[model samples]
Target: MNVEKKRVLKIFYLIATSSEELSSCELAKRIGVTERTIKSDIKQVRDFALDNGAVIKSRRGSGYWIEVFDSDKIQAIVEQLVIHFAYDSSLSDLSSEKRSNDILRKIIAQDGYVKLDDIAYELYLSRSSIKNEIKEARKVLESFNLGFETKPGFGSRIKGSEFDKRLCMLMLFEIYYHKAVLMFNHTQLMNYFECEDDVRNDIRHSFLKVLRESSCHIMDDYTQRIARYLILLRNRYKAKYYISFNPEKKVLLKSFKQYKIACDIIDELKKYGGYDVDENEILALEVFLLIWADIDSTSDLAGDYGEVYFEALTQLEKISERIRQEYSIEFFNCEWDKKIFLTGLIPIILKIKLNCEKNDMKSSVLFNDSVRLSPLSIKLSYSAIELLNEQYNTKNSFASHLIIAYRIYIIISKVKYDYSPIRMIICSMHGIEVARSIKNSIINKYSEKYFAKLDLYELYEMRALKYDDYDAVALNYPYFSYKYDWTFVLIELIPTDNQLQELYNKVILQGYQLKQFLEFFNFNKNFVFRDFNFESMESFINLISFKHGKESKFIHNIEYELNECVIKSIYNKTCILFINHQYVDHNIFEIYQLNEIKNINGEEISHIIVLSVDFNHSIKAFKFIEQLSHQLVIDRETIYLLTESEKLDNIIDIVRKGLNSEMISLV
Candidate 1:
């Protein structure tokens, strides 16, 4: 049945079975379509109902119901519709995407040219609808370098290299039948492939057995993909369609270990199904297995294949570096992560370089909405594409970019939770035992959960220690005379429940505040200047505040604030000048390594670090800058690194580490 007729039948069944009358709006909602579409289908539904011994009754505003006269005839019609068109009711319209896939499949599956009328008749669509869907299908085919040729009487056929055709076919199968195979819905697979249960099971067994003997571990989804490819290959071969590989390229493929594995699989197929596949078919299967299956070792692929692996690794390193430079974040911090990323990336590189078809059809539908929302992921994907295109001279499809973006998002998200511990100091007037007791209680409750480090200290030691060394300071008695720069809270000697809970909340808040503060320190190379020269403080401020085009009034406000604020010199010889200002529209942080030391008010300045925060910035931003300024004054090593470090990444790393150490104080 045509899609419209099926929809019309569905509407009649709904009105016939519904207990209450359904309005056009209500029917549209239930059917997952617009009210106008429901209205359009209503006339056809009325005609269908009348032919099936029922009449659809409609009132002005009351909506639709059904009146059945011939009960037996109406019952039979409803039963047939339920059996065939019931599953389609929940689907919105026969969407253009799906219709295109159907049309593409029909043309590809045919031997020569497929008539438009035959497709329209088979799909129950009009000539016009089929033509529109053909355009969409043509775009997809063109991606694989396949051509859609249509003549007056002969209709249409996809014209491309056999390899490209198979690739397109593999992509289509992945889109349409992968889920069924994944679910082990054998009946659905059998019906779709037009194969018997025995034949399907034998093909799966043959593929798995070959993989097992070769010690190859294919992911379950990929295993299903190969099986589907084999089924399609058998059908295509039966129709006298075959893949032909280049003579030289076929010789190079035979040297790979996968070629042997493919031979074994073809041997099993011939054994079980009594069918012989050509050498080109074996080479094609080899390429499929190499792309989809995971082998135990790359040691077996020693020569040309190893060169491909190394080339992919080189491209990956460049892509990773580009991402790091652009985002100021590492793509993969560990070797294991790099290996995982490289493994996933190699197939994409091969798919592009070898002109292999894309099989991850679901990525577009799965990630289109979510990927656009993540600018970082989108940027990372573009970086990867740019690098890959530079290296291989081929552009990735939109689907490939989505897959890369999805992977990048997963890695970046995992990096977000790498938290630094919050350091806390407990002081008691009584003795060490009392301080220990308070520390133990807090640790037992919140230490592991909140990633806190608690240390016991005597109240007399408070005057001897620096407050900036710890994130929070808890005391048994209120010592008003001694000033504290850190978060301060008082408790009883034993510590009350309320006091401990308050301390826990402070620890959590301090950690969050520190994390927020550290985010501003993540500087890209573009923001870092080396050997910078400025004649005066005014020129320096203007240079730092310089943005492209007309500068906002906010930039002038920032310059005013910086000019009014004191620039403190932390060291004598290699003076690290720190300037922090507020009342800006956005947070700004930059470092300028001076070409020549300048004396300002008899203090020599070698490096200048400028920080500006929004007027309505959080307390965390203020606290972070305050703590960092204090550390630069006290910690000589940090100041030395700030003035002396030549590499931009190292400088940024040291700044982050210095601030983290001030807050965390990890033992």
Candidate 2:
């Protein structure tokens, strides 16, 4: 019931219909197979037709003709085949296995003549599987052949007269050439052929042709369409795949049987769900899916996908009642029209949504799935390829899934095509976070390709770098100032109202002093600073309690180094950054300990007490949390968060709190 296998069989019907009394030679030429193949296929064709009540017979020694038992039988067989194709697709491969066995039996009984590769392919086995079976056929059917026979190279033979032998051999070869033969490799054949439009369109069409072949499930048609659809699907998604069997599942168990269409839209609620994208791009994605679907419509990818396609047609006839009965878009329901296929409307719809506009503004062919990137905005060399990456990596996507991507892009285009300046805000529920990380990785991998822009809002779209909330991007080392501008901004956790105001005041008062220090020492043109929680329980001694000196020595050292730095200003000014690290917490021992300790601004100022001389700052909270070190109340991230902004408000609050009690300045 393998859906793909059934589709391939359908291909045989088309190939078979294209010829007159097609012999093994004719079939091999038309279907691009070999004579050996045709020889084996005839038997399969006979058996399949007979099993379904068709007659494949030879008059004496001329050739073969396939006719159903009668008109009713033919109609019934066609209907049955279609039904089987539509219900469960997993059994088409089994049909080949059965056909192969039937041929093997007939060859042994009538003569050594059977279509082999058909079964081999349909069974998803290798050519060797057929060879091995054929070798054993003579022994298994010896009684039927009366020990009739096969030489090293000669095919199976009946002991009857030469005329009978020729008849059987001819029919056998016919089966091999048409029914059983596996024809052109899809990829290679595509290379040989020139597509009508772009590579993507061509690929879509080739897949459709193969799907049609598979739908018929005729042996010859199957031969003509081998591997084409799989190859194309792989190309579209950039995914590699091959039929695999699970020994545990034993899907091929003769008793196990449920074969239907490859994909049933009704059952696949996800793939075919109604409109999952924005208006601008929905039509485009829809049209694109239709084109893709049409190319491989041999089976039903029509799951959720079919709804999009069906709606596009505006099926005013059948859906007329449904449309009027339900949501009412007007009762102009009909098929999407053959025009889409002829004019490459699907691709047009997609490309147009991507800004590849076409003449028809309202072609229902469009489908906008947010996974697709902006068309109005310039796209990468292979933007579609990036989407394919999602298909391969996560088996899901935004453009193909939720409409968030499209909405984001619309916002971005309004602001500017380049989202480098904007910070992309992501919620846990949104899928952008995943894309954000991946995009950053890609950016780092190809630094030259990007200008090193960090936009949180467009992180997923542009492969931007990641910046944690409130984490300042170090602008230290004035020599490197020219290389970058516009420091990335992240929101800080303003612990409390007191802390927020304290920061504003600290920045305003210490603005010039701090700016001078950075300009002289670290050469940071733009100082990004902030403070987290403010407390009254801490003092300079608290820093000393942090196992050693002030744990926030990192901040102090940065300030101390900046104060000692030489400025390029014409005034030849030297600046000092006095930050008092005392707060409400009474862990004074860990508060004010660093280099060149002394009293400044009425409090002890810590020097290069931190690990880095450039990241020095006052961490009064660090001193407070030091008391709970064993319990590890404050983690590294907390430390980072507390020092998110370079503003001294938190430090000021700490100083004010320390003043309320007994405070000591280490500097």
Off by over 4 Å in 2: 1-19, 23-41, 70-353, 356-667
Candidate 2 lands at a TM-score of 0.17
- Per lDDT, the best of the predicted structures is 1
The digit string of per-residue lDDT tens for model 2 on 460-511 reads 3322543433212211123332232324222132124443233223221221
Task: List the candidates' TM-scores in order.
Answer: 0.57, 0.17
What lDDT score belongs to each candidate, Candidate 1 first? 0.63, 0.30
**Once model 2 is optimally superposed onto the true structure by TM-score, how far is the C-alpha of residue 70 displaced, in angstroms?**
6.5
Which residue segments of model 1 deviate by more than 4 Å? 1-9, 12-95, 121-126, 174-192, 212-215, 293-304, 317-341, 357-360, 363-374, 406-421, 425-667
Q: Candidate 2: lDDT of 587?
A: 18
Global lDDT of model 2 = 0.30
Flag clash pairs in model 1: 2-124
